[model samples]
Every structure is written in C-alpha cells, then in structure tokens.
Target: MKPASTMRPVRTAEAATTSLFHRLFPVNRDIAIKSIFGVWGAYFVFVTSRFLYVAQGNVDALFVQRILMTSICITSTWLLYRLLIAVRGRGMKSAIFMLTLPTVVLANYIAILDQIVFDHEAVVFDFSYLLKAVDFASFDWAYVLDEAFTRYFIFAGWGALYLALSHSQDAQRMMAHSRQLERVNRESELRALRYQLNPHFVFNALNSVSSLIIDRQNQQAEKMVDDLADYMRAVLTGGAQDMITVEQEIAQQVRYLEIERMRFPERLRYSVDIDQATKDWSIPSLIIQPLIENAIKFGVSGSDQPINITISAQSEGDRMRISVANDGRVIEPTARADDRSTGTGTGLTNVQDRLRTLYGQNASLLLANSKDGMATATIILPDPSQIFQDI
Candidate 1:
C-alpha cells in the first residue's frame, strides 16, 4: 500500500489535469448539438453535390437513397466523436485511438449501407439481398481500406483544428491573469509609499508644539495645536489617494507653514511662485511638504537673520520642475556623524523613496546649494495630465 502523503500529490495532479481538460474542451450540451448539426449540414451539402455530379443532374430514387445513407454515416461519426470526448476526456493518446478506431468501423458500415440500399436493382426491398450484400466473402476489402483511410484523415484534421483553438483561448486567459497581478502589485507599492509620509511629518510638527509649550509660549502653542489638527486631518483624508492636484498639495503645505511661522514669526519669511497654468496639474500628495519642513528645520533654525524660504513650480516641455529654497544657510552635501537637526535625514529619504515608487526613474528629488547662499531642493515629475491618461 502507498503512503497517504504520497497518494495525495498524485490525486491532486490528476484533478488538476481533469480541470484543464474540461476548460480546453468544454462539453456543454447546447454547444455540442449546434456544432454537430452545423458539421453534418456541411457534409450533407458536399455529398449531395458529389452525387449530383456523378448522376449527371438526374434526381432519382437511387440518388435520394444514397443521400439518406450518407446522412446516417455522418451522424454516426459525430456521435462517436462525442462519445470519445465523454469517456476519454481529451487525453491525447486516448483521443487519437478512440477517434481513429471509429473511422474504420464507420467507413465499413457506410460501405455496406451504400451497396445494399442504393446499388440494388430490386423494385421491392428484401432482407435476403441485404444479408448477401454484407457477406464477408463477397465484400471488397480494397474498397473498405480506401474508405477507412479517407475518413481517418478527415477526423484527424478536425482534431488538429480543435486543439489549436483551445490552446489559443488558454493563452489569452493566462495573459489577462498576468496583467491583473502586475496591476495589483503596483497599487500595493504605491499605497505603502504614500503612508510613509504622514508619520514623519507628524513627528516633527508635534515636536515643535512641545518646544513652544516648554518655552512658556501658551498662546502660540494653542494656535499651533489648532494648525496641527487641521494639517493632520488633511493628510489623513488625502492619504487614500496616490496623487492629488498641485493646488491641493500647496494648500496643505501652506497649512503646515502656518504652524511653523508661529514658531519663528520674526525670523521666518516664505513665498510661493507657482505658474497659473500648472495649478491644476497633479502630483504625489504631500510630496513637497517634507522638503519645506526640512528647510524650516535646518535653514531658518540655524540662521540669526531673517531667512526667506521659497516654493515654486513651472513646466519645461514634458516635465514639471519644482523647487523649495531657503536663504538661511548652505546645506552640507552629506550628513555629518554628529549632526542632529529636527529632521536628521528621514524626511528627505521618505520623499526620494516615494518619488521612485511612483515614477520609477522618471521622477527625481535633488538637494544642492544655490549660487546666492541658499539651500535648494528640486523635483522633476512627468506631466500630471499624461500620468492620468496613462492610468
């Protein structure tokens, strides 16, 4: 006896094979009946035409008899094909054997019917003549061989056509399934990148509120709490989408800046220079907020004089270029070992990862020192309308 564990895999494989067979050659009654009728109809027309040609356009009793006999042979051949499909289930070896075996038997049966029913000269039908007609000693073995080979090739051709159609349908179904899986994976990765931005922004905003409370600025702390509340609500609501219009994103950023301006009213100055044409363009939600937050933390916080932070966007052919710049101090190209700003490096890294996830290598975020003693963060993204059209 085989072990149960070993038996299970064999049974599973058999079941899967059976399922594939049914998918390839479905045996629905309506479809089978329609196919059989259509095939036999075509066969009837061809046989009738051949008989008319041989008889020289004569419509006589012998012609009618030959037509009826050929009809019976065609119906029998179709029935045999259906039976093979039912009993053998499309296994290549079994189907070939069963389909071919019937051809020889059916051809011999049709030959006997033709000889007895159509070639007889008797005015009255007689069983004695029919019996002698089918006798093995009198039968033409050569004729039977010719008929069998003809029918065998015809059925083989039919099987080849059926298999070709079945394979084509299977290929189409597999391709559709593969595309669906790719789409699902892309959506999942985009959601993960979108979620990463919220917590990082929240942590820094909350820290600023704590600082205000510690410095005994109660009025400013209360107002910052309100602004933070509004900002959190906007972020949470927009988090459900992978991208939003540039106008909406800038509004959220302005709310965030409102909270920061309260913390450094005297030393922080900011401006936005977005083109009117680019206002309705779409961008990854909260994509630029972290860059602005980084500017306030490192640029304004490290400076004694009033520092102006600027956010601007413009279209350059196929790409949208956005920059956030501050005049507080030049940012070092790399982080130092002991550097501890409000956002060490998490904010910038989060933005870079989100850009890569959304646009592969087409979008980018870069940080560099400007010619006028300011730190600038620039981002380039594909056009918003084109992105929407692609989706």
Candidate 2:
C-alpha cells in the first residue's frame, strides 16, 4: 500500500516463481513426463537465449527454427521416457546398451532434418531426399560419425539421469509411507494397552460401590456412582486419545480417588502436588491410575490406620518427573521392585510396559521407598518436548 511501484516488483516475482514451479512440476504427478518437460524446457530456453545473444541477424527466423528443433528434441525424449517406463528395470544393462542403435539412428535423423529444412526453408522427412542429399562430392562421413558419437551420449545420458531420479523419488515416497504406517500401528497398540485397564478397574470400583450399599451408606454410594460416571466420561472422550495435559490427568485421578474415598472415608486421604510450570506438560493418559490403585491395594490391605496418597509433578532439567507415592508401606530397600505384599505387581508392570511403549528407553518408571513409611512410584520422561510431538 505504500507505493504501487514497490508492490509491482513483489507481485511480479511471485508470478514468476509460480510460473517456474508449474513448469518444473506439472498438474499431474508424472515423474517421467515432468522430468522430460522441465529439463528439455530449460535446455531450449538456455540454448535459444545464448544463440540470440551471440548471433547478429535473423532473430525471427532463428526463433522459429529453434522452436522446431525443441519440438523434435521433446518428442524424441518422450519416446525414451515411454521406453524406460515400459521396460521398468528389466534387463536394464542390456536394454540400455541396445538403446544405442535407436539413439544413433535418431541422432542422424536430426542432422538430416536440419539439412532439409535449411535447403528448402521448410520441414521435410522424405527418405528419397535423404538419399539425394548425400550425393555430394564433399560429403564427409567422418564428421557425420563424430557428430553422431557425441549425440549418442546426450541421448543415453538423458535416459540414465531420468531413471536415476525417478527411482530415487519412488524410494523416498515408499519410505515416508512406511513411517506413517508404523506410527498408526504403534498408536493402535497404545490404545489396546490403554483399554486393558477398563475392565479390571471397573470391576474393583463396582465392588467398592456394592460394599457401600451393603453398609447402608446410600449417600456415599450415590456420590461414588456419580463420580465414577464423570470419571469415565472424561476418560473416554477427547483427552483419552493417548495424551493428556498434566492438569487434566490430575483432575481425572482426583475423581478416581473421590470414588475410592467412599470405601475408606476415614482411612484414605490423597493430595496432588503439581508445579504451576508442569501443569500444561503432557504425558500418556491414564498412566498414573494403576500406581494409585496399587498403592491402595497394598497400603490398605494390611493396615487399620489412615494412608495418605500423593500425586506430584515437577520439572527435572530437560526431563519431567511424575510420581504417585503412598504412606501405606515403607518400601524396604532390599525388596524387589516387582514384589508387593497384596498383589502380583501387575499394576506396576502394566504402567512400566506402557511407558516403554510410548517413550522407548528414553522414559522409565522407578519404585523407591523410604524408612519413614513412604513408598514412591515415579515416571521420569527424559524429553517432555518430544512426548506428544507426533500426536
């Protein structure tokens, strides 16, 4: 808007770029045809421009003569493109060697066509005239052979270049397609692992609800049922497609504990300790649920006193740390991590499997315990920035 003159150059450059792109890459994605058109078109423009620059006369006739020459070159190369496509790597070495015959024959045809057009001031392809033109006393067979020799390489070189580029592009396209399929298959596997939790978790939650009803605690039972519905809704909806913000995950787990609170209203208390900086960070959804379940199962099975479960998230250098810890049992330093008192450690194993699937070896789940009646299950993500990048 500042000046029309200044804007004109930008618009002109954009138009030129678009025109060049269209010239190189045609409307349809035909690599063979596209390569021929682009290379030959560039060659024609360059050769014609050079001729016009260096020569002193006959600009209009030279333009027409060059147009005819370019048309012939395009047609000849197109036939080569078609031959390469049809052969498609069969007897490739022998086939290319045999192509020398056609290349040599066609190259001589170019020389003949040029001679006829120059003599008659018009295009002609008469075979009889070809015999007549060679009746000259000064006919040099040596020069013709030399010119044909050079032209042979030009034709052969063009065909070889096209094949190399076409094969390379095809390979690249295949590799990209393979990577996409791998991603889809991995996501499907993650989903299968995620859904494994549903049946086991629902069975436990229903049993807890049933216990509440038998104890004549109708109000707590109703509250737990409502919380369970809300929790399922949050999980099966938008946030469950493999990743969830630390904040959303914390919210979902809080709902889970609210249901469990019905069972141990006095004995179960939980806390969430998420740093403000880590709330928006993402992790695999429902990853921490199993650790919490194990905490309650192992911690409450042998104790009559209150147990405090804590969920915490914090940043650790380039990594992010998420832990579910409980005051249920002190993890003895000598105890195997997979060994717990009340269960077969399936919950911890499941969480560990999921972390390995999502982050490979770059992420880990660790079980640590302290002497002060504290047991911790922590997940360490080495690169939070890469966790949800693909998703």
Candidate 3:
C-alpha cells in the first residue's frame, strides 16, 4: 500500500499533464449539456426560419414538418447521450460500437418521419411505387438507406464529440484531485521534522525518564515514556492519511504537549477548549501541529514567565475557526515578512500551504497578535456540513 500510494501519483500526474485539450476545456457536465442543447437548439431554429423565409405563408405545413423532424432528431440524439453515460469508461472501441447502433436507429427514425410529413421529389421514386404490393409508404427502404448513408455521419460525429467531452472532463478532474493529494502526502512527510526529532530533545527526555526511575517515581517515568512513544507515532502516521476528526487531532496534540510538559513542566502550560460541536468535524491530520510547534519553540524559548498556550475551536457562522494562542510573545505582523526573524518559517508556511491545497479560498490561516496580546495563528475552514458532503 505504501509503495503504490506513494509512487502512483508521479506516473498519473505525468500522464495527466500531457493533456492540453483537457486543460482548455476542463471537465464540467453542466457546460457540456448546455453546449449540446445550444447546438441542437440553434440547428432547429435555423431550419424553421429557412422554411418560413423560402416558402412564405403558403408553406405553413413545411414549417410544422420541420419542427417534427427536428424534434425526432433531438429525441434520438438525447438517447445517444444517455447511452454514452451508461457505457462511459469502456474503451474507445466499445464506446464506438455502442454509439453506432443508436445512430442507425436515429437515421431510420428521421427518414420515416420525412416520409410521413413531406412529399419530396424523391418520394415519387422512394421505393413506394416500385413495391406497390408492399407497405412501402410506411417503410421507404431506399430513402431510409439514403438517410442512414448521409445522416448517420452526423450522429456518429456527435457521439465522438460527447465521448471526448466525457473522458476529458474525467481526466482533468482526476488530475486536479491527484495533484492535491500528492501535495498533502508530501507535507505529511515533514510531520516529524525539527524539534520533534532533535537529538538534544530525545536525550533530555531519556535522561528525565531515567531520573524519575532513580527517584522511585516509576509511574511518572512510565507515563512519560508512553507519551513520548505515542506522540512520535501520531505525528509519523501523517503520511498515509490526510484527514481525521477534530477529536482525534486534539488527542494526538494532547500526547505531544504531555511529552513537552515533561520537558518543561513548570514553564510550559497548555489547555484545549474545543467545542463539543466541533469534535466530529473533519480536519487535515497534523494540520494544527505546526501552530503548536511554533508556539512552543518561539513562545517558550523567548519568555521567562510561565507561558500559557490555549488551543480553541469555535463554530463561527459558516466556518470552523481554530486557533493556537500563547501569551508569551506578541509577534509584530511585519516580523513574519523577514524569514530570518522567525527562524525556520516552515511551520506557519506549511499550515498555510496545506489550507490552500485542501480548501482553496474557502480556508485561510492568519498570524497576528490577538486583543489579549497573545500571539495567535488562526485557521478558518468551511463548516463540516458544507465541505463533508462533497468529500
């Protein structure tokens, strides 16, 4: 699963990128249906107008016949649309075979309609008189054959056009979604980077565990060891999955902060005020880890007083607002513009990029000093009800 999941996108993206036609006419069913209606509707109007102008008021019968003929053609071709949808994703050979049968039926339908409505020069020699003993008026074999010979091409052409639109739209959408998932996977790989895997931090944790065991605080040492193991496992598991519930995310963060608390028990304090309503909401896994990491690394490192970090999730209108705020540092908004001032700016940028990739304009990440003088990074994303249905 890991090898295929990790490498399949590289091949799929490469194939999908070569499709310039799909890019220009992206996959949209509504647009495709509108174009079909627009073209057929225009053809109907043009034929009716031509009959009216050429014959004037003397040929009202011809105008009515033209409407009937256009209606038959439109109905037959709409059946083709339904057929195309039913046989979609079959290979071109199968699709073409499926389409050819309907075009033959459509041509026959139109040819029969012509026999009923109009008396053309061809009707005189339209196999009706040749086979006087048979019902040639109802089934003009020659005229039907002639219509099939000429008008079969039109339905065939429409079939091919529909196929192109169907497959192109699927390909283009698949490509877009595949690229976003690949981006998500790449970001997830950075989950265990920086201070989480720093050698000094690992050493400090081990030494602290050993000191607790030496002082016969075996329960504290055991709990710290468990927390350390659980935290690493949680963050490292980010690669394969992109989304989890808000409740699950907060649980993982709690493990992480518990481990950190062992490291700076007196200096670092944290709390979670997640709304009960938001526990079921979907969020990108480890999406909030960056904010927490930044708060601890910058906020805890720079401050002498005990820094209180608060993580909160609130339901605000049509969005779910989540924030990680710390009272230690009041970050100047302009300071973020200088990459050097914020050390490794990877955390904030990673959160921002993930938000954009996952939710586009519907999601946002902001870093600023709050009214209480706490440095906060707030993420605003679509409410679960709105976004989850599509997912």
TM-scores, all models, native as reference = 0.65, 0.77, 0.52
**Clash count, candidate 2:** 0
Poorest stretch of ten by lDDT in candidate 1: 118-127
Query: Compared with the true structure, what per-residue lDDT tens digits does model 2 show for residues 206-266?
Result: 9988988999989888888898889887777654557878898888899888887777878
Candidate 1 lDDT tens digits, 53-156: 57443345445665566667666656665656665445777766766666557666666565556445533333355555355666566766676566656555
Estimate, for each residue in 309-354, the C-alpha lDDT of model 3 and write its tens digit: 9999998767798999998555654576576745556667767766
- Where is model 1 more than 4 Å wrong at Cα? 1-154, 198-201, 210-219, 328-349, 367-369, 384-391
**Which wins on lDDT, candidate 1 or candidate 2?**
2
Q: Which has the greatest lDDT?
A: 2
Q: What lDDT would each prediction earn against the true structure?
A: 0.70, 0.73, 0.72
When 1 and 3 are scored with lDDT, the better candidate is 3
Regions of model 3 farther than 4 Å from truth = 1-219, 238-240, 332-342, 385-391
Best candidate, TM-score: 2
**Candidate ordering by lDDT (highest first):** 2, 3, 1
